[model samples]
Target: MNSLWSGSERVRIVERLKATLAGVVELELLRCKHLEMVDAALEDRASAAANAAELPAEEGIRAPGSTASEAEHGSTTSRRQQVSAILKVIRGHIGACVGPVFNPLLSPSLSPGYDFAAVLEWFAERVDRIILLFDAHKLDISDEFSEVIRALKNHEDKMRVVLNKADQISTQQLMRVYGALMWSLGKIINTPEVVRVYIGSFWAQPLLVPDNRKLFEAEEQDLFLDIQSLPRNAALRKLNDLIKRARLAKVQAYIISSLKKDMPSVFGKESKKKELIANLGETYHRIEKEHQISPGDFPNLAKMQELLNAQDFTKFAALKPKLLEAVEDMLANDIARLMAMVRQEEAAMPSQTVKGGAFEGVMTGPFGHGYGEGASEGIDELEWVVGRDKPTYDEIFYTLSPINGKVSGAAAKKEMLKSKLPNTVLGKIWKLADVDKDGLLDDDEFALANHLIKVKLEGHELPAALPEHLIPPSKRGSSLEA
Candidate 1:
């Protein structure tokens, strides 16, 4: 009887182990299936987005809603809403370092230019610069690279080329490679020097030798000299100046064209003159609000004092109608003055340019535009255009049609908020709507709220500039005013 009991216990143990192994296998399969589903969804969404982006502008699409009106508006609005949501979520998960967010190893290529180009276009409307980094050892310039380079050159002087992997090659080899790259690239692009290259392995460190202080010091000096000899800093300054000038030029051309179109109507009748004056007043108010300054505050000494404290000469210049219309030309003159100042500053310094800001490794190519999810080092403040009253992400995406797909999840929430009045404006309207001081909005509150926004558009002052009180006093100057 004892022998039989022992045998049964051993058999039970064996069965338990089998069950545990089977459970692990099942879990793995489930994970694989989930990943596959995610990939398929992403592919479908990407294709839809691409098609929507190409749709003609005549189609009037409302924001994404379940209603027939939204569907008829075509998929453009839906796509943008979807993309924005995905990006927002992806951005949030970037630093988590846990599971595969997007298949990191899906593409083996070090620098995929086509993928990079799409990213550039998305950022073009939002930022002034885009930097691309490459592993010099694996550098293979493809058609995609040419396309990106062309697009960047045409857009403005904001594209920078960074060549990485310096520690892998000897100093002599690095210099030779740099020269070869510059010579080959010089023929194709206007500014060969703009393709900045640097050599250093983020993963590798120089070997330290014990009791060899002199040798170590000599090696360090050599590295410093090599870095100094690189022309990256000079190249970046030139590029920044070039981009600023280009932006100014584009603005100038637009103003001139607009003025030419409007010149005929400016000289009509007394009635026309009155109408024009009203239009001009409205225009002035719109411009002031767009710059986030109060309409009443303008024409007041206090406002001018505020402007001076802010060092916002650009906003001051924008207020003048002649300057507003000719903003491009005005900006061009500003750029020229800025360039002269930079040159003067450089000349005064022993080092031609300060090795700081975004230009630090300009020549050595250490600064590449390739930023990973977990790798963004500094604060990223994005400035993009939206209509008066601080349009929401949904409104901007619907207007621009930058991304193409069905909006979902957190993106939907953000878009919903964006479509409504801004929080500050909403808060003000809510205050006016809520006759009772309770926090929640009931039926009466909702009806009154709608009425307020309708009237708010007609005569309401832009929401009190996002209060500086929200920001720490030390950082108030840098915070974005809603």
Candidate 2:
């Protein structure tokens, strides 16, 4: 719900840059019309006040400098002041109300230091020059920077690529990275044979810590100490370009105006804003068909959301029992398959004196008092009994209370499990199981968690789990030896 991202729930954003641009054009026109209306009304009101004052003079019934005329004049002046105040408010709104339409650009070709390459390209398009920076340490460009890729295609001549963090790598590595970059940018962007690539670290100056200090090569410790020539040349080039653009900016405006005359509205004005929005929808549909943009493209956003939601331990604890049952159900066949392998392994081992292992362990943990109802796990085959590829959150949810696979009355079983564990552990149990912080864990994590719930928290019989691998910290070494 925060305004940082896709906050405009009412509208869909897509391939409608021109539609928004047209709105920008008409917005100015509408503001002019509205201001004209206000000015005309004010003039008419002033004229009426003057005419009323003149009526008394024409009828010869007004005294010199009458108080009534003065009061009427004061009222007219106050009304004008109110009109000006209203206009000021409108102007402020006009400047600030375009956020919903102007955020979240579609771009690709990302490098480490050039995070804003896309936005800079958009700004570069509106202006005359562009100075793009990239970390020399990060050699390759990512496919996410679609905007940067497009900019290179269109404005390669106008861009100056600065190779930042020049001191991070050895000169040999730097040269190789630069060479690879040059080849890649040329092949990928298909720019000129040679585009400017300056070498400097613009903002890496700070007292280095132990971990980060080792990053710089020995010879590169004070590299580019007095590197100003490239930047100065770039500045001079910009100055020359600025003077040329300043002289011809008027002609450019005229050309833009002529182009606007030919541009037609994407939809009619039944409601102009609504029409533009509908046009954007159509454009998106077409774009979706041509270039598929999937949710996978924004995995980081989904990851961040999952992390934020995981912070709410109370809600997670409430849902833990249902989630556990769901996952246990989903992985039922897998578990059975694993248990068979474990049994086979146990049979392969040399026969030993039937020491009190499962019987003693189970009777001690929450499994005591006949809470556990499963075949005892074979010795030394605990962890392998459950396969890897940790259970994802989706599998757990779908298994227990399948949105599409729900059971009619499974709450009773969950209540039984809840009864086995203490109130304290059950309060925030999900945190114990979600070991990887990716909002999921495999069956091993689940087994270990349930074991802790019964044995550690409730001091009851530990249920079916990895015996030695998931033993309590104090007894783990002994369990391993035995």
Error at 329, model 2, angstroms = 81
Model 2: per-residue Cα lDDT over 1-482, one tens digit each: 12222545213322232333343334334334534655677689979977777877788788667886577667656755664575467442201111111123322221222234444443454433345556777755655443455543455555556666776777677779888878766766564457766665556485222232333322222222112222323333444443333223222222223223323446442354333333433433443354343322221222223232212111111112332233333233333443444455545555432224222453355434332322233234545322332344234433555332322224213632664665555434445443443444334445444434544443343433343444434434544575
Q: Estimate each model's TM-score.
A: 0.28, 0.23
Scored by lDDT, model 2 comes in at 0.42
Write down the TM-score for model 1: 0.28
Local error of candidate 2 at 241, Å? 8.4
Clashes of 1: 16
**Candidate 1 regions off by >4 Å?**
1-118, 122-130, 154-160, 169-176, 192-194, 204-325, 328-482
Model 2 vs. true fold: TM: 0.23
With candidate 2 superimposed using the best TM-score fit, by how many Å does residue 196's alpha carbon deviate from the native?
Answer: 1.4
Deviation from native of the Cα of residue 108 in model 1, angstroms? 16
